[model samples]
Target: MKLPPIGSYISTSFIDWPGHVVAVIFTKGCNWRCPFCHNGPLALGVAEELDVGAILDDIERRAAFLDGVVVSGGEPTIHGSLPSLLRRIKGAGLAVKLDTNGSNPSAIGELLNEGLIDAVAMDIKGPWYKYERLTGKAVDVESVKRSVELLKSSSIDVEFRTTYVPHLMDEEDLRMVRRQVEPGRWVIQLVDTRLALDPALVGTASPERARVAEAFPDVPIRG
Candidate 1:
């Protein structure tokens, strides 16, 4: 099976996949444009093309040393060859983790049902009302809800994360997000304004972890 076109690859990363050493593959092209996105190049589909055979060969060589492979985006689910890519990775005796925006529930469902992904990290921008404002695009909030439900019911390790942009989201918005996806792991990620997609947010300060924790006493905050 032919692998999807890759935007970039990290030979080794400890933080991408929790408790595991893995190679990270960044896929090109995103469905939504978030002002706070740090990977504007990838999101805009301006990434360099990589050779799939070489990537697989490298993975095969490092399989003995690596625990898994993380497929992140530009929204990995947007690629049609993602399943094939995951299959190849699994065939190499490595596990697969996918990072998505939860905009494509059908793709996520197919991967989960087929047992192609071992873990998932889905990003929930904010409450339904703020999605369009945060993403800078029209969003299908229903699809995001469906995706959340699917992951919550799945047996795999799933985590829903929201990047807390102080200007775009407030304490009440965070609370609303927590309520919408109750009884699951929710992580609050602090935004890095240096590389924000929107120039206006270039110097915006991120919310302090302690302050966010105080605001969201029930939810977990990640720096």
Candidate 2:
């Protein structure tokens, strides 16, 4: 089976899955160029590709201590063979979580239908109007909405995440996202503007993290 372009691997992470420890696969490339993206190299596919097989072997060796594996991005769903990659990890006795930008509903639905993913964490860019602006790409907003609807009705676990980027979005924008999706499991993250894909945003002012959290009342991913 063909493997996706694996850019980087974290052998273990406690935060990626919140309550559980898991290995992380940061895939190379993305369909959208979200300026606030922190993984500039990976998103641009400039990060050196790693041996995916070896990393899977490592995770298999350490599987006893891990609760799951998180397939992150550069938009994990963008990879056509992502299900194959997840199957290998699942074979290693690790549950899998996928992080995505909600740009591809078809991929997400396919993975769920095939029982390849145990959970999905999709990022909500902002209100629909801000999508093209934040992503710096021509976007089909309906695709993103379809992703949300798929996750919303899925039997598996899901979390709709939105980063509170002060420069790119406001509290009202976040509220609009919540109103639009009404996800039961939702989280609001504060963007660290010090580092971003767009250099102009670096060192930009951000809202108070505590205040943002208070307003959003996060549904913890942690168990």
lDDT of each: 0.91, 0.87
- Writing each residue's lDDT as its tens digit, candidate 1 over 166-217 gives 9888888988888877888999999999999999999898998888878778
Window of ten residues with lowest summed lDDT in model 1: 214-223
Number of the top-ranking candidate, with TM-score as the measure? 1
Q: Clashing pairs in model 2?
A: none
User: Total clashing residue pairs per candidate?
Assistant: 0, 0
| Clash tally for model 2 | 0
Q: Residue by residue across 1-223, what tens digits does model 2's lDDT show?
A: 8989999999989989879999999999999988888899999999999999899889999999999999998988888999889989899888999999988899998999989899888988999999998898999999999999999999999988877778888888988988877845788777777768999888888778667757766543221
Q: lDDT at 209 for candidate 2?
A: 64
Kindly provide the TM-score of model 2 when superposed on the true structure, using C-alpha atoms.
0.95
